[model samples]
Target: MVHGYSGKILWVNLSNGEVKKQSLDMELAYNFLGGEGIASNILFKEVGPETDPLGPENILIFMTGAFVGTNIPCGIKTTVVSKSPLTGIYGESIFSAPLGLDLKYSGYDGLVVKGRAENPAYIWIHNDQVEVKSAKHLWGMDTFETVDAVREELHDKSISVVAIGPAGERLVKIASIISDDSRAAGRCGLGAVMGSKNLKAIACKGTGKIAVSNPERLDELRREALNIALPNTKTLREHGTAAGLIVFEQNGNLPIRNWTRGSFPEAENITGSTMTQKILVGPNPCKTCPIACGRRVRVPSGPYAMEGSGPEYETMAALGSLCYNSNLESIAKANDICNRLGIDTISTGQTIAFAMECYEKGILQDTGGVDLTWGNPDAIVKMCELIGMKQGLGAILGEGVRRASQLIGKGSEKYAIHVKGLEFPEHNPRKFKSMAVAYATSNVGANHNRGSPMLVERNLLSPELPWKEPVDGFLTKDKGRMAKVYQDLCCAVDSLGMCKFMVFWGKLPLKILTEYYGAVTGRALTFEEFMRIGERIWNIQRAFNNRMGITRKDDTLPERFLKESVNEGPAKGQIVELDVMLEEYYRERGLDEDGKPNEGKLRELGLGWVADIIHKK
Candidate 1:
C-alpha cells in the first residue's frame, strides 16, 4: 500500500460515462512527485499539440500531491492540468480547496476526465462510489449557487463542489473554476474546457483516513514547521495577500493604468490593510493550513454590498491599480462577481484595463455601453460583469487580452501587455528584474505560480536555497541561475500538493520540505534529489510546450517591458534587460538556444520519451 497517496487513479470518460479505478503507477510517482508533476507527465503523453483545449480531445486531470492527506502543514493544494484554451500550450491551475482534500480521502490520488458529455453533467464522487449525473438543472447557475445546489441535491453539506458559472458555460477564455464558492483554480481558461465538456460541477465527499509513513516523525515535523512557519507568516496572516499594495506602489511594482504608469498614488486606499479595516470578516484557511492567508470578506451594505472571498494582491492590482480604481468596496464587488462568474480576475482586469487604454487612444470608440474612463470604479465593476457574462464588448474582452487585441488592433497590441496569450497578473517585471525571466519562460505564459524568482530577489524567501546571498535586484547578474532554481523548486512545491505560502512566505527551509515528504511517503530525498524531481517535471512541461511549437522566440516578455521604460517612480527609466538573462537562463536550464530542452538534458532527466517526441531523433 502506498503510505501517502491512495495509489488509485479515477479515470472518467465523460463521452461514454465510463468510470474506472486503476492502480497508480508508483514509478511515475517517484519521478514526478504527484500533483502537477504526475499530471503534467500524463498530460504530455495523453494530450498532444493537436488537441483542442475546449474540444472533447483535451483531458482535464486533477492530481493531489503525496502530502495532501498527511500531517504536512499547508499541503492541501491540488493541480489541474489540461491543454490551454487561452495560451494554446501548457495549462495548469493550483488551488487549496476542500474539494481536493475530499479527493484524497475518497481513495484517489488523481482524477482524469476525458471526452464530452452529451448534456450538462457533474461528477459525483462518494468514496468508492462514483457517478456522472445530469447537471442540466444546475447549468445556468453561478459558482456560488452551483455549489449550494449541488450540496442540496446530494443532501450532503460536507460534499465539496468545484463548479463553473456563466462565464465558463459560455466558454469564456478567462473563465476560472471556483471551489466551494471561495477558492479558485484561476488560470489558463480551464473552466472553458470544463464548459466544453459540459461538466457543470464535481461534488466530492470522502470518509477514509490517509495512511502516512513514520506518523510520529510526521507529527513532530509538523509541530516544528508550525513553530517556525507561524512566526514568519504573521504579517501575511494579519493582512492577507494584498498587504503589499502600498509597498508595491512605493517600489513601482504596482501596475497602474494598463502598465503605462509607474505608480498608483491611491494604492493604500484599496489595499489589504484597508480591506481589513473595512470588509475583512476573518481568516479563511484551507485544510492543513496554518498561515490562513486566505481572507473572508464582506461589504456591509451598498451598491457593492456583498462578498465571500476577498480580493488578493493580484486581483487588487488587476482590478484596483491597473484600472486606476482605488475603491476597496467596489474592488470587492468586482472580485465577488468574478468569483461567482468563474472568471480569472487577472485576465479580466487586464482586458478591461487594455480597453480603458484603447478607449483613451481612440482605438475603441465605445466600451460596450459603459464609459471606460480611468479610475472609474463603476466602469471597472461594470466591466467585470460584462466580461464574465460575455455581454456585448465583454464577449471580445472575454476572449482574453491576446485574442481581443488582435480583433481590435491599431497599436492596441502594444498595450495588450501579455506574454503568449496569458495576461500579466499584478507583478511588474521591470520592478523586479528576475520576474522578467520568470514570466517570459513560464510554460503557461505570464505565470507567477510556476516560479517567482522575484520572491528571492526581494529577499522574501528563506536562506535554505544554496544561493541565499543578497541579490542586486536591478542587475541581470545571477538572475538566470535564480530563475532556474526558482522555477524548479516551484515545480517541486506545486507537485507536493502543497501551498507555497507556508514554505515561501513562512520562510521554512528546504530541508523541512524534504522531511515532510520523507515522513509522508518514507521517501527521504536530499535537497538535490528533491530539486531533481522538480527539474524533471519542469523539463516535461517545457518539452510538451516545445512539441506544441514553442521556441526561443515564443519565450519572451511583452514588448512593453522590453521597449518601454517606466519614466517615473522607483523603477524610473527602467526596462527589463531580458536578452542577457534569457541567454544565461537557457544555458542554466540546459535548454538549447531555441529554448527546447536538449536531447541530452531530457534523457539525463529520465525523459528519453520526451526527447524522442520534442527533438527529431
Candidate 2:
C-alpha cells in the first residue's frame, strides 16, 4: 500500500473517449517525487521534438504532490505541464486551489489528457467514476460563467471546476486556466492546449479522505507550521502581495513604462495599503493556507467598476506602472476581465505595453480604432477586452508580443522585451543582477517564479542560506551560485505542492519538509536525498528543452535588457551583465558550454536516459 498517494493515474484519450487507470510506478515516484517532477519526466518520454505545441499530439498533465490534502500548510498547489503554445518548449504552470486535492481524494494522483475530441466537451470525475460530457452549450462562456454553468449542470455546488474562457476558446497564446473563478494557472498558455483538445472544463467531486502514515505526527507538524507561518506572514496577510509596490519602486526593481524607467513616482496611489483603503473586501485564502495573502476586491461606481480578484503586484505593475497608468480601479477591472476571459494578465498587459511603445515610436500605426497610448487606463482596459475576445487588433496582440512584433516588423523586436517568446514578468533584472541569470537560465523564458534570486539578494530570509554569501543587489559576482541553489529549492517546493511564500515565512526548512514527508508517506528521506530529487527534476526539464533545440544561445535575456541601462531612480546607469554571470551559472550547474547536461552529471543524477536522448539529437 502507498501512503500519502492514491497510486492511480487517470489517462483520458479524447479522440475515442476512453478512460483508463494506470498504476503509479513506485520507482519513478521515488526518484522524481511528484507533481511537476513526475509530469516533466512523463512529457520527456511521450512528447517528442517534432510535436506541435497546439496540436493534438501535445499531452497536458495535471498532477498533485504527495503532501497535498494532508493539512500541510500551503500544500494546495496543482502543477499543469505541457508543450507551450507560446514558447514552443517545456511549459509548466502552478495554481493554488482545491482541485488537485479533490483529484487525489477521487483516487488519482494525476490526470494525463491526450488527443482531440470530436467536439466541445468537459471531463467530470466523481470518486471512481469518470465521464466525458458534451459541453456544446458552454463553449463560448467566460471562466466565471463556465464555472457556474458546470457546477449547476453537475448539481453539486461543492464540486471544484477548472475552466477556460473566450481567450482559450479562441486559442490565444496567452490564455490561462481559471479554477474556482478567481485562482488561475496563469502562465504558459496551457489553456490553449485545452482549447485545441476541445476541452471546456474539468469538474471534480470526491468524498474520500486522504490517507496519511502518522496522523499524530502530521498534527504536530501542522501546529508547528501554523506557529511558524502566522507571525512571519503578518505583512503579507495584512496587505496582500501588492504591498511590494512601494518597496519595488524604491529599490528600482519595478518595471515602469515598458521597462524604460526604473521607478514610478505614482506608485503609492495604487499600493497594497491604498487597495485596502479603496477596494479590499476580504481575505481570500487557498486550501490549507495560513498566510491568506490573496485579496478579494471590488470597484464601486465608475467606468471600471467591477468585483473580482484584486490585482497582485505582477498585475499592478503590468497594467498599472508598465503603461504609466495609476488608476487602481482600472487595474482591478483589467484583472477581473483577464480572470473571467482566461488570459494571463502579465503577458496581456506586457504585450499592450510593448504595442504602446511601438505606437509611440511610429512603428505601429493602426490599432483598429482604439487609442494605443501610454498612461491611458481606458485604452488599456479596452485593449485587454479586445484581446480576450480576439477582436480586431486584439487578435494580433493575443498572439503575444514576440509573434506580433515579428508580423509587424520595422526593428520592433528590439522593443518587444521578451526572451525565447515569453514576455518578462514585472521585475527588472538590472536592479537585481541575480534576476538576470534567473530569467536567462530558466527553462521557461523570462519567468520570475522559476527561481527568483531576489529573495536572497534582498536578504529577505534570515540566518542567510549557507550555500552562498549575501551580496549587494547590484553585484554580478556569485549570483550564479545564488541562482542555482534557489532554483533547486524552488523546484523542490513546486514538486512538493508547497507555496513559494513559505520561504519568506521561514517555514520551509529542509528538516521540516523531510519530517512532513516522512510522516505523510511513511518513508524516511534525508535532506540530501530530497534535494537531489529536485536537482534531477531540473535537469530533466533542461534536457526536454534541449531536445526541442534550446542551447546556450537560447539561454539569454532580451537585447534591450543587456544593451540598455536604467536611466532613473536608484538603479540609474545599471545594466545586467548576463554573459559574465551566465558562464559562472553553467559552471555551477555542471552543464557544458552549450548548456547541455554532461554525461557524468546525467549519470550521477540517474538521468542516463536523458543523456541518451540528447546524444541522439
Candidate 3:
C-alpha cells in the first residue's frame, strides 16, 4: 500500500490482465526525478529497438512528477511517454492537471501499460483497485461523447479521463489523446499507439492525499514560486501567446499561403488584440498554473458559434495565416474539431494546408469535388471533419506529411514541410535562426515543446535582459550553444512539471528550482546537481531514439526549408542555412561523426551506468 503522501506505480499487462504494483523506485526517483525523466529511464530499459511503434509490444507510460498534485505554481503538467508512430523516435507529450491530481488521488504516481488487449477495452482505477473493463459499447464514439458516457456510467462527474476520438480509433498517425476537455497529449501520435492496443480510455478516481516531504518548507517555497510566476501570469492574461503574432508578423516569420509567403495578407484580422476585443470570453488555466494562457471563447455570428476553448498561437497560425484563412469563426471551429477529435492542431492544420497547396498545383485532384484554396473557411472545416473521420482524401492526409507526400508524389514532398517525419509548428524559421536549430535537433521531430529558443531570440535578447542579442532570425552560425542551453533548461523545467511560459514572466532561476525540489523531496542538492540530472534525463531520451535507428541524417529540415526562400516580408529571400547550425549543434552536444551521444560526455554527466546505451548498434 502507498503511504507518506506518495502513490504506487501500477504495472498492467493487458494481454493477460495481469496487474501488479511496484514500490516507487527511490533510487531512480532521487536520481532521475519524475514524470518525463522517470518515464525516459523506464522506456530505455523496457522498450526494445525492434518494437514497432504501432505494435502491441510497445510500452505506453502515463507519468506525473513529484511536484504534481502540489500547490506549486504551474506544477500541473504530466508526461505521456511512448514510441511515436509519426517520428519513430522517443515520443513525449505533456498535459495539464486535474488529470494529474486525480491520478495521484487514485493512488498511482505513474501507470505503465504494456502488451495489448485482445479486444476493445478501457481501464478503471479506483484508489487501490484496478479493472480492465470491456469498452465495446464505447468504441467508435468521438472523444467528448466517450468521456461523458464513461463518467455517467461510473456515476462520478469528477472522474478524470484521458481518451481518444475517431482520429485515434482509425489510427491516424497524428492523432492525439485528449484530456480535461481541452488539454491534450497532442503530438507524436500517442493516441494512435493507444488505439493500436484496442484501448479506448482510462478513467481514474482516488481519495488519497499526496504528501510533501517537508510541508512547511514546501509551503514557503510555493509562496516564493508564485511570486516568480506572477509576472508570467499577467503577461499571458493580457496578450495571450498570440501576442507574439504581431512580433512574428513584423519580423516576417508568419507563414502564409502554405509557407510560399512569409507575411499574411490578413494578419490584423485575426491577431491577439482582435480576438480579445471580439470574442475573448475569459482566461482558462491548467491546474496549479498561474499563467492562464488558455482562452475560453464564443463566436456569436460565425460558422463556429458554440462556446468552447479558444485557439492558442500555434492553432491560430496553423489554421489561420498558414492557410490564409483569416476568418476567426472558422479558426475557432477548427480548434474545436482538433480538440474533440484528439489531433495536433499544429500538424493537422499544416497537413490540410499542404493538401490544399497540392490541389492548387494540380498535384492532387480534389476528392468528392472538395476545393483546396487559400482563405476558404468552408473548405477548412470540411477537411477537418474528413481528417477526423478518416474519409476520402483525409485518409491520405491523415498519414502525416512525410507519408502523405510520399503517397501523393510528384515533387510534392518538396512542399511537405517537416523534419524527421513530424510537422513544424506555426513559427517561421526564416525570421529566427534559433527557432531553426530547435526544430532541427528536437528529439520528437519539429515540436516546439522540446525547447523553443525563439523566446530568447525575440523576447529576452534586448538590452534590458541578461542575454545578448545575436543577428536577426535569418543568420545560422553560433546557434548550437543557444539550442543546447535552452534544451537543458527545458528538460529541467519539464522535469519539475513547470510550464515554459513561466520563464518569460517570472524570474525562475536554478535557486528557485533548488528550493522547490528541496522543499518537496526533503533531499537537498546543489544547483549543479539539479542541472546535471536534467542533462542526464535528456541524454537518456536521446539514447532511446538513437537505439530506434534515428541518426544525424534524420536531423534535417524539409527540402523547401533548405532550398526555397520566403517570397515576402522582412525575412524575404531567406532559407534556413541548416548545415552550419547542425554542425555547431552537434559539436556543442558532444556528438561524434554520426550524431550519436558522446560517450565521454555521458560519463562526465555521471551516466556511466549505461555508457553502452549511447553506443548501441
Candidate 4:
C-alpha cells in the first residue's frame, strides 16, 4: 500500500468533458516523489516540443507533495506545471494554499486538465466524483468574486477554489492562478494556459483523511518542526517578507527602476517595519504552516482602502523599487488589483517598469494620454487595471514584456529584462553572483524561487554548505557549485511540499525530511537517495526545455545584466560575469558545451530516457 498518497490520479479532458481515474504507479511515485517532481515527470512524458503553450494540446497539472494533507509543517504548497504561455517552455509554479490539501483529500494524488473546453467551464471535485460545470456566469468575474461566487453556488464556504480572473480570461501572458483569493501560483503564466483551455476555476471539497504509515512518528516530527520553526521565524512572522526590503536595498540586492538602478532611496517607506507601523492588521498563516509569513493589511480611508493580503518582499520590490514608487498604500492597491485580476504582481510590475523605460527612451508612446513615467504610482496603478482588463494599451502589455518589446521594436528588446521570454523578478543578479547562474538556468526563466543561493552566498544557511569555504555574495568563484547544491536542495524541498521559508527559520535538516517521508510513506529513503531524486527532477525539467530547443545560448542572462554595471549603491560598478558563471555551471551540472545534460549524468540519475531525447535533439 502507498501510505502517503491516495494512489489515484484524476484526469479531466475538457475537450470531450470526460473524467478518468488511474492508479498511480508505485515505481513512478518512488522515483519522482511528489509535487513538482511528479508534475515535471508527467509534463516531460506528455508535453512535447511542438506543443503550443496556450494551445489545446498543452496540459496543466496540479500535484501535491507526499506530506500534503498530512500533519507535516508547511506542507500546504502545490506544484502547478505546464508549458508556459509566457516562457514558451517547461514552466512550473509552486504556491501555498489549502487547495492542494483539499485535492489530496479528494482521493487523488494529482489533477491533470488536458485539451480545451468547447465553452467556458470549471472542474468541481468532491471525493470520488468529478464534474465539468458550465462557468458562463463566472467568466467575467475577478479572482475574489469568482471564489465567492463558486463557494456560494456550491453552498460550501469551506471548499477550496483555484481560479483565474479577467487577466486570465483575456489571455494575459502574465496571468496568475489565485487560490482562495490571495495565494497565487504566480509565475510562468500558467493561468493563461487555463484561459486557453476555457477553464475558469477548479473547486474541490473532500472529507476523507489521509492515512499514514506511522502516525506516531509523523506526530512527533510535526511537533519538532513547530519547535524549530517558531523561534526562528519571529522576524518573518512580525514583519512578513517586507522586513528584508530596507536591508536588500542597502545591500544593492533590490532591483530599482526596471533593473537599471540597484538601490532605491525611497525603499524605507515601503519596508515591512513601516507597513507594520502603518496598515498591518495581522499575520496570515497557510494550512499547517507555523511561520505565518503572509501579511493581512488594511488601508484606512484611501483609494487603496480595504482589507487584504499585504505585499510581500517580491511584490514590494517589483511594484515599489522596480518602478521607483515608494507609496506603500499605492503599492498595496496595485497588489490588490493584481490579486483580484489574477495577474502575477512581479511580472505585471516588471512589465510596467519595462514600459516606463520604453516611454522614457521615446520607444513607446503615451497610451490613452496616461504618461507612464517612472515613480508615477497613479500610472502604475492605472496600468495594473488596464493590463488586468486587457483594455487599451494594456492589450499590448498583457502579452508580456518579451512579446510587447518585439511588437514595439526599436532597440526596445535591449531594455527588456527577461530570460527565456519570462520577465525578471525583483532580484538583481548583479548583487548576488550565484543568482546569475540560477536565473540563466531556471526552467521557468528568471525566477528567484527556482534556486535562490542568496542565503548561501551570504553565509546564512548553516551547519555549512558542502563547499570548501564560505561563499561570497559578490564573487563568481565556486558559485556554480553553490548554485547546483542549493538548486538541488530547493527542488527536494518543493517536491516534499514544504515551504521554502521553513528552511530559513527551521534550518530544516535532511534527516528530518527523510524521517518524515519514511514515517508517512513507510519507505526508508536515505538522504543521498532523496537528494538524487531532486537531481533527477531537475534533469527532467531541463530535458523538457531541451526538447523545446533551449540550448547553452538560451542559458544566458539579459544583456543589461551582462553589459551594464550598477551606477550607484553598494553594488555600484558591478556587472554580472555571466559567461564566467555559465561555463562553470554547465561543467558542474554535467552538461555539454551546448548546455545539454550528458548521457553519463542522465544514466547516473536513472534518466536514460531523457538522455535519449536530448541525444536525438
Candidate 5:
C-alpha cells in the first residue's frame, strides 16, 4: 500500500455498468503528485480531441492531492477535470469541503467516471462498497435538495454529496457542481457534462485513514504552518473573500457595467465589512481549514431574505457592481440561487451584465418581457433564476456569454466578456497587466484560480523563488516571467491538494511545502524537483489543449482590454500592452511565438511523446 494515498482508483464506466478498482500506479502518483496533475495526465492519455465534451467519451475525474486526508491544514480541496462543455479545451474546476477527504477515505485516490448512464443515476460509495444507484427521482432536483435527499436515503448525515441542479440537468453551459449545499466546483461548465450523462450526484462515506511516513514531523510542520498562516488569514476568517470587494473597487480591479467602467461608486454598500455588519452569521470552514475563509450567513426576514452561504468577493462583485447593483441582500439572494441551482455566479453575473448592456444598446430588442435594465436589483435576481431554469432569455444566457452574444448577434460579441469560450472572472486585467497574459494563456480560459495573477501582483512572491520583490503591473518587463513563475507555483500547490491561499495569502514558503511532501510520502521532493513537477504538469494541460488546435492566436485577451482604457481611477488610461508581454511570455514558457510548446521544451520535461504528438503533427 502506498503511503499518503488510498492506493486505489475507482473507475465507473456507466456505458456498461462496470465498476472496478485499479491499483494506484506509483509512477502516475509520484510524477503528477495528484489532483489536477494526475487527472490531467489521465485525461490527456485517455480522452481524445475528437471526443465531444458532452459525449460519453469525455471522462470526468474527481481527484485529491498527496497532502489531503493527512495532517496538512487546508487539505480539503478536490479538482474536477474533464473536457469542458464550456471552453471545449482543458477544463477543470475546484471545490472544497470534506469531499476530497471523504473520497480518499472511500479507499480511492481518484474517481474516474465515463459514459452516459442508461437512465438518471448517481454513484454511492461507502468504504470499499460501491454502487451506481438509479437517480430517476433526482433528475430535476436542485443541488441543495439533492444533497439533502441523498443524505436522507443513505441515513448518513456525515457523508459528503456533490450534485447539480436545474441548470445542469437542462445542460446549461454555465452550470456548476455544488457541494455542502453552497460551495461549488465552479467554472468550466463541468456541470453541463454531468447533465449530459444524466448523472445527478455522488455521495461518499469512508472509515479508513491515510498513512503518512513521518507522522511526528508532519504534525510539527502542520503546527508551524497554522501558526504562520492564522495571523495573515484573519481577514478571510472574518469576512471571507468578500474582504476584497471595496479594495478592488478602489484599485480599479473591479469590473463594472460589463467591463465598460473602471470604478463603481456604490461598492461600499456591498463591501465585506457591510456583509459582516448586516448578514455574516459565522465563518463556514472545511475540515482542517485554518483560514476558515468560507462565509455563512442569513437574511433574517425580507423579500430577498434567505441565504445559506453569503457571496464571496468574486460573487459579490459579479452580481453587485458588475450589474450596478449594491444591494447586499439581493446579491446574497442571487448567490443562494446560483448555489442551489448549480450555476457559476461569475459566469451568471457576467452573462446577465452582458445582456443588460446589450439591452442598453438596443441590440437586444426583447427579453421575454423581463426587464434587462442596469442596477435593477429585482432584475438581477430574476435573471439569475431565469438563467438557472433556462427559461425564455435565460436559455440564451445559459449558453454562456460567448454563445449567447453570437445567438443574440448584431455586433454583440464585442460586449461579451470572455476568452475562448469561458467568461472572465470578476477581476479586471487592465489594472494588473500580468493578468492580461495570465487570462490569455489560462488553459481553462480566463481562470483566475488556475493562474493566480491577483495574488502574485499583490507582491505575494514565493520566498523559495529568486524573485524577491513585486513587478510593476503597468510595465511589460518581467511580467512574462511573473506569469510563468506563478502558473508553475499554482500548479505545484494545486497538485499537492493544498489550498493556494496557504501559499499566497498565508505566505507559506515553497521550501516548507517540499518538507511536507517528504514527511508524508517518505520521498524527498526538493524545491527544484517540486517546481519541475509543476512545470511538467502545466505542459501536460497545455498539450491537451494544443492537441485541440489552441495556439498563440487563441492565447489573447479580449479586444476591449486592448482597445479601450478606463478613463478614471488607479488604472486610468491603462490599456494592456499584450504584444511585448506575449513575446516575453512565450520566451519564458519555452513556447513558440505561435504559443505551442516547442518539441525541445516538451522533450526536456520528460514528455517526449507529447512533443512527438505536437511537432510531428
Candidate 6:
C-alpha cells in the first residue's frame, strides 16, 4: 500500500448514538478521485432524491481528497456535501487546508453524519477513535467562540475544529462552517444542514502519517509548484483577488447598486490597491497554497479600530459599491462579523444592499422608523450585526435576498438579484455574456467559481477584448463556447485539489495533471483520459440536479438582469440577452431540445455507463 491511504470512512448514526468506521473503498477512490467527485457520487447513491434537505433522513458528509494530509502542495482540501436547505438539491461546499488534513491524519478519509442527535452534541475524532459528546454549552456560541470552547474541551491546541455559530444554530440558509480562524466551507447553506443535525462541532487530532508511492517524483512536483509560487505569487500577494476590483471597474464589470448599474462613484478608494496601502498588515496563505490571496488588515485608531480579515473583491463590491458605502473600514468590519458569526459575506451584503434599496424606495422602514439612506456607514454596521445575530428585521434578512424580497414584496422581487435562490456574486453578467451563461447554468446558483472567464474575455492585459478588436464588456456572442471550456477546466481543478488561479497564467494541462496523478496512483493514462474523468464527474453532478427536478426552465438569469439595462458607466445601456446566449450555450454543451444531455454526447464522453440512470426518469 504505497500510494494507498490509511484513512477510514467514519459513519455516525445520531438517532441511535452509534458510531463506526469502515475501510476506505479503493475502487471508489480510483473511480471518483475524491473531493467533489467522490462526494457527489456517494451523495447521489446514498441520499434519496425526495429526501427533505432539513430532515433527519438527509445525510451530512464531510469529505477530503485522497491527497489530503500528504506533503503534496495544495492537496489539503475538503468538501462538505448535503442536500441544500436553500436550493433543495444535491449540494456541496469546498474548503482548504488544516481541517481536511487533520481529518485524514485522524485516520478518516471522510465523515458521514446521519440522523439528528437526541440533543446538542459534537463529534470528537482522535486517531481512529470517534465519540459523540454533549455540546449544549457550545450551541449558543459564535464561530470564533465555538472553536475556542471546543479546543478547550479537547485540551489540545493542535486539534482542528470546524464549527458553526448562532447563524447555523438558527438554521440561516446562508450560514457557514468556519474552521482554522478564517477558512470556511461558506456556500450553499451546508452549515444549515449541520444545524439541522443538532451537531455543534467536529474536532479531530491525528498521530498517523500519509504515504505517497514515489517520493522523488512528489518532491519534484513540490519543487515545480514552489518555483511557480515564487515570482508568480506576486499577483495574489500584491493585490489579493481585490486587485481585480479596479480592473473590474475599469472594464465596467463591477456590480454597482444591486447591479442596476455596473460602475461605482468611488471605485478607486474601495479598490484592492487602496486597501493594501491603507490597512493591510500582512499576507495570509492557506496550508501549502503557494499563492497567498488572503490579507490581514488592521485599522488602528480609526472609526473601525479592529484587526481582522480585509474585504476581498466580492466583499468590496457587494458591501461597498452595491450598498453605496464608500467606507473601507465598514467593509472590513462586515467581513469580520460574517466570519465570527459564520455567515456568507456575499449573501449578507447582497441582502442588506437589497434592503437599502427597499428603504430608499420606501418599501421598508426601520422598526423605530429611522431612514436607511445610502452610504450610511452606521446603519450598514448595525445591520451587519443584526443579520449575523438574526435580530428582528435581521431575521428576515437572514433568509437571504430571495426569501427576504418575497416576504416584503412591493415589486421588490425585481431587485432581489439572485439566480436559483442564491444571491449573485460581485461580477455583473450584463457586462460579460460568458458570465451570464455560467451564472444561468451553475449547479450552485450564481457562483463565479464554476466558470470565471471574466479575465479571459476581458483580456485584462490588452485594452482589446477577446472576441473583437474593439472591447465591449457588454457585448454577447460566442461566449457560450468560452463558458463551456472554462466550466470543464474548472471542474478539472476542483477534482485535482489544485487552485483555479494556476489557470490564470495558462491552464495546468492534463499532461501536468496526469504526470502528477501517475506519480501518486502509478496509473499510466493520457491527459485526455484524466480530463474525461473530470467531464464525467461534472455531468454526474449535473445529472444529480436534474434528478432533483431541475429543468431547462430553471436555467435562467434574474429578470432584473435580463430586462434592466446598465444605467451608468462604460457599460451603460447594456442588458444581458441571456436567452440568446443560453440557447447557444445549450448547444455547445451538447444538450438537446429541453437542454437534457444528448445520448450521443454522453456516449462521446464515455459517460454512457450512467445514461440509463440519468434518462430512466
User: In model 2, what lDDT does residue 614 have?
Assistant: 92
Clashing pairs in 6: none
Which digits, one per residue and each the tens of the lDDT, describe model 4 over residues 52-102? 989999999999889898888888899999999898898988899688888
Off by over 4 Å in 4: 467-470
Could you tell me which residue pairs clash in candidate 5?
none
User: For residues 234-268, could you state the per-residue lDDT of candidate 6 as single tens digits?
Assistant: 76778787887877787788877777766676888
Model 6 poorest ten-residue lDDT run: 461-470
What's the TM-score of each model vs. the native?
Answer: 0.99, 0.98, 0.95, 0.98, 0.99, 0.93
Question: For every candidate structure, what is the RMSD over all alpha carbons to the true structure, in angstroms?
Answer: 1.0, 1.2, 2.3, 1.3, 1.1, 3.0
Give all candidates' CA lDDT scores.
0.89, 0.88, 0.81, 0.88, 0.88, 0.77
Clashes of each: 0, 0, 3, 0, 0, 0
* Model 1, global lDDT: 0.89
- Taking all chains together, the TM-score of candidate 6 against the true structure is 0.93
* Residue 479 alpha-carbon offset, candidate 3, angstroms: 1.3
Inter-residue clash pairs, candidate 3: 5-211, 232-505, 431-473
| Residue 19 C-alpha lDDT in model 5 | 93
Q: What tens digits encode model 1's per-residue C-alpha lDDT throughout 14-68?
A: 9999999999999999778899899998899898878989989899989999888
Where does candidate 2 stray beyond 4 Å?
A: 462-464, 467-469
State the lDDT of candidate 2 residue by residue for 1-617, as single tens digits.
Answer: 78888898999999999999999997888777789999999999999889998888899999989888888888899999999999999998999968899999999889999999999999999999999999999999999999999999889898999999999999999999999968989888889999999999999987778899999999998788778778878878988988989999998998898999877889998889999889999888887887888999999888999987898889998999998899999999999999999999999989999999999999999988778889899999999999999998899989999999998899988889888888889888998989899888888888988887788777665342564445798999888987887787778778888887875555445578878989998998887888788789889999999889899999888888888887789999988889899889999899997779887899899998788879665
